[model samples]
Target: MSFLEKPRVLFYLLLFLIFGVYLSTVSRTVSFGDAGDLITAAFEMGVPHPPGYPLHTILGKLFTALIPIGEIAFRVNLVSSFFGLLTILLIYGIIYKLTKSPLAAFLGGSFLAFSTRNYFLLFCFVYGLALTNHLTIVFLAPAFLFLIIVTIRPSLKRSDLQREAEPKLQAEAKEGRTFPGSLKTFFQELFRIIPPKIIGLGLILFFVGLLPYLYLIPAASHNPLVNWDNPKTWYNAQELSGLKRILTRADYGTGRWTSTTASVIPSGRPAVYQLLFFSEMTFYQFAGLGVVLLLLGIIVLAKKRNWIDLTFLLSVFLIPSAGFMIYTNLSYTDSAALSALERFLIMPYLGAAIFIGWGIKSAADFLKEKLPQFDYRYFAILIFFPIIFHYANVDQSKNYLFYDYGRLMFDSTREVVIKKDDKAVAQPTKA
Candidate 1:
């Protein structure tokens, strides 16, 4: 196929199928809880402290003002669904950039877009706004990935740094004598790694510098997650504490004990482990097997000294997943109940995928060189299997999947609008 001719047709065909499912699943007749509240909060300009998202509220208001639909519910969710597509596209672009292979990129975007959690949330539910969380994850994942690629992609050479550092050296050359001793060493190393003139005149953008902001974006300072300043609601902290205690525990006694199936408390997170350390959280929890693959992948990336695998390790180890491990193992009672481990780390999922893709591709390429015409198409299929599996699991009648933010908007005005008269009434002056 020359990696060029007609693959995008397949890519977009997949996207259309996803969109079609989303369109068919919207529940026009029945409205639900939080989805309606988001719409309501939009017109009213705010929402209850602990769980509200101001940026999301502002977006909801803008949609309602323009659409003028009787039910703002489906409309609001549709917006996040659109961003979900944007997330998919961005991943597609980045994966293309990382692999220089169109098929790999398509597979990467497909995996992310159809990730069971991502798919169910983006396509199946009224909680269109809820998809924003993963959209946030997918979106910044690329920006962070871009940052990584930009920082290291072309592999900066020492000669290039010397040329860029020209002006400062010119000053030293002109003087033909000792500049300040402290300044001499500084510029020497500066000239060694970066061009002196460019270092002074322009900013050197690096991965370590800009990435912290992704984590900070979700913190929402000034408009803190809760009104911590007010003492009357002080016990809101305690309420969060109590709620965590109740829901996080695993009671095998709960759920169906007899229905042809059994559920366990899941003392471990297999996927988190598998994706990070080479051990599946549960299914492939064998000793030493995963560790060897983990080391082999690490050695491949390390031999090349590439940051892709390192970033994947960080995402797997440090970035918080929307799963039970964070609630149970990484608990910090005072923080947002579900958001304790670090949603800020969410910025790196794309980078994680990129590095993992590169790591796998690079390893396979090296082995193929030794194996005499080893075909790697099967490797591609296996890597993409996760995406296919996720789509199947997440395609549960689309309506059941999302968290329903429109339900928040639907009732915002009724729940919050003030009923005061238009004209101002005069009050007596105090002596």
Candidate 2:
């Protein structure tokens, strides 16, 4: 029996129920910041030519047309909610495909659904920030997905890249014919136990995975997650120069030293003298874990020497993180990487999660060889972190506001319309 069929249905039904309840009772708190702006842009413009978010604004406006855009709160929040669910499902699909661990996938999905990061954005985060959450989930999930695809192929032997292994690994590659030496084994592991002869459908989903990154276009107009433009909040992207440039840009038209520090701290030196630019975003510890896994996977790859695991690790984790590091040096605020590049690079996270889960499974397997006490129960404990984080996130769902607790964040009066700030205008357009 397929475990996914039942669990996914249950999850979907629960998501619908919870979302319906949230909208019905607490819908009053539904938000509109950046996403509303995108929707507004969509109504004003069409495909390929929306103001900022060509992806979200167009999509959100189209959807809202079917529903009611009358309420800024509900419409915007719902759009993100829909994509958020898609992300959860996508994660499951990747885990199932990559790790072949349905239990791990279920646990991973539960953890993501209840994470504090997601919770704060969905419930309490401000408008634009909350909408960014959609991007985070959308692109991140797919990035992980494609990374899995790319890495999975290499895990098989060279001949398997085109043909099937002797047997099917997952249900998909059931019809492969195996021949040759190491080549036969490689074909079996990537797409299926046998080789997956089909391509169109998988290819579509793989490319479809990248669509969420479009929101970054309009997102740049503002400081994104942190108020980097606010001198106080610069370096939110983990670049010292980024903070300096952001405030410098904010000081447009007025060259006041207070507004723009220019040479305030000298090049090659930090303005604030901190260890790193961002907090809560960098995945130093986790990345380290991935590095460790890569070294180990390389050893396992000796006989198999699967480039997929190695590529998955290097490309997903190292590449993106390295990109952020480079941005820190070259110093372009417009192009400056997110401080949370490590987090946003969800491919790495997926790999890490897979490897970590696998490590748990492997350890359990090894211990089982020695002692009977070690079993899936040990892995169950390993799965609890994300689950607890997710649930804790949901409990405080209503209080989180997408952005900060400023008047712009929650203007209950409705009289204080935001026109002075283009970003303020952009907030509700796509939400």
Candidate 3:
């Protein structure tokens, strides 16, 4: 059978292509902002800014050390590229689970994988690793929860038992015991369906993933040349690595929702303005028709009552975009600030891409049934439209915008310093 018939083969092929593209376009050197600090810290085995991101520091350092062919920054950037590819692979698995059709999953995965937005966001993990990132990934929690639950649900029992049991459970829920009692019972049932092995494996993997964070204590002690916040002592390291600093981002500025830092947009503009700004950014990224397809996909998923998939998509999108709008104090007037905040919307945009795939598939199937003469493959032509457009915008081959910008900034600073020195020399000595 063709690879398409056996989805795993198709997934690997697509993953190879994704990795190749990112590898070719990976940054050659540190660009700006936190990147300089990240690469330096990783290379020197030093602690980074607040939250320390020991995990990222460890991986980046490993990549830098092992990859002898490139600049330190380039090697570190490869870490993001690696995780980015893995995220795309996970997305493909997610879509395949939601829709058994390999073609649909392939299209969904490829659309997001090739898109310009993911090129920067690098899945939600990149956000966590890219210390300068955002809380957008928080929104994906519910989605992941739903995905895990659904995946395990089928393996728990036969289809007949599940269908019959759900109704009885729903009736009990409707009769309503004390809220806490009901909640406890709900979880008890959920736990029963999930295998103990699955639970143990998940816990083990999570903690193992977190082992990288332990690298912070040693890195902090080494007193690296470029250490930020100077987490040298046990007490200071504890404070910086504490929940308060990591969650509230106390290292940079106020961690509160109201705190207006470089990342936060001003609180002056109305909510509608921010909505428009976000909509405009998304439109340009996904294109107009792509947006429509996403909405249609939501409707299609909803009508079919694919609650697990539907809820996951909604949580991923709404929690970041809609919920963030209410809490974030971003201003509508500061175009630069608004534009900067647009990156946080990447997670929601990812949900839109998945929906777009579903919508296209739904439409193709409907048309095929209604109009027997038309080939379903022709409908796939629509999928290529977004890919073509996104590739055109994100084609990074030989792109040196960041390099040029960094050079200009460095030159400007040097000139300013020189001018200051010249003035100091020229001035008459004071009494």
Candidate 3 on 91-147: residue-level lDDT in tens? 777767766756676677677666666556321134523323344556567778878
> Sort by TM-score, best first: what order?
3, 2, 1
Local accuracy of candidate 2 as per-residue lDDT tens digits, 40-144: 344443221111334555455555577764444445455555665566566666655655666555555544444443432342122222234222233234346
Candidate 1 similarity to native, TM-score: 0.47
Report the lDDT of model 3 for residue 39: 73
Over all chains combined, what TM-score does candidate 3 have?
A: 0.74
Task: Quote model 2's TM-score.
Answer: 0.49
Winner by lDDT between candidate 3 and candidate 2: 3
Candidate number with the higher TM-score (1 or 3): 3
Cα RMSD for candidates in order: 12.8, 13.8, 7.7
Top TM-score hit: 3
lDDT (0-100) at residue 287 of candidate 2? 26
- Stretches > 4 Å off in candidate 1: 2-14, 21-36, 48-52, 65-70, 123-303, 308-348, 359-388, 391-431
Provide the lowest-lDDT 10-residue window in model 3.
419-428
